[model samples]
Target chain A: MSKSIFYHAGCPVCISAEHDIVSLIGAENVEIVHLGDNPGSIEKAEKSGVKSVPALVTPQGNVLHINFGASMEDLK
Target chain B: MSKSIFYHAGCPVCISAEHDIVSLIGAENVEIVHLGDNPGSIEKAEKSGVKSVPALVTPQGNVLHINFGASMEDLK
Candidate 1:
């Protein structure tokens, strides 16, 4: 499986989506990063042009889950 | 049909969950309240003992969808 990064901001939605993301992307395959606690998270998100949390950074360099919940079908 | 209130905070997850909620609770049955835009939203939420958004106040006086996505099964 390709690398998938899940960035979260400790919001209720982010908290809720964490389980779904792990279930869809596989816990081992996804590097869960808490934007509020992780160092350089803001900088990284800004650099990547990510405007929101609960965002998924796919191996293809596509950022998703910025506007909606990450559907299992969409993740796969 | 009962009065079901959906409280949201304009978060991406909240934005995404809106449709799911409407589908589960029926559009006419659910009143969508944006916490940031609506007057007295904060006060109402506080009075209701709501700490977060994406919350569903059921007619039964149960508050759901505060921590997770509003599942159709759960709502029904």
Candidate 2:
């Protein structure tokens, strides 16, 4: 299983997205990182060019900017 | 009992925040509005000046911009 890290900055949307991602990818596979609060997450998020909160970083180091929109259908 | 409508645009953060708000406020008191998909939400969001996702609208018509940061403490 590929490991995923979710980088966020405390936005409510980020909080909400965390649930969907966990539901979609399983909690065991995903790590929730709050950039402003978590140590080292700020640098990591910066490296990924995360301009917004609730970005998803996949195992391949691909950062997905999920700032647009999501649905139950999108998650499933 | 107050009605809260969560306006979002499918961002992961918004999704994650939705879970927290529900847990904090109870699902019965909250309504999730997807501005991109839900009819009339876009107009409402625009009127509310929601430039970002994961905004919360209270029964009093107060718009809360949850774009910066949130913690478990902030929610509780």
lDDT per residue as tens, model 2, A1-76: 5677877666677776666556545688778887657645566576765555667766666555554332222232
Off by over 4 Å in 1: A1-76, B68-76
> TM-score for every candidate vs. truth?
0.43, 0.43
Model 1 C-alpha lDDT per residue in residues A1-76, reported as the tens digit of each score = 5666778767677776666556434588778888767746666755664555677666555554433433322222
Q: Kindly report the docking quality category of candidate 1.
A: incorrect
Q: Per-residue CA lDDT of candidate 1, range B1-76, in tens?
A: 4667888777777776666556433588778998667746667655665555677666655454443433332222
lDDT of 2: 0.61
Chain A: TM-score in each candidate?
0.76, 0.76
Query: Could you tell me how far off, in angstroms, the CA of residue A59 lies in candidate 2 after the best superposition?
Result: 0.6
What local lDDT score does residue A49 receive in model 2, on the 0 to 100 scale?
57
lDDT of 1 at B16: 62
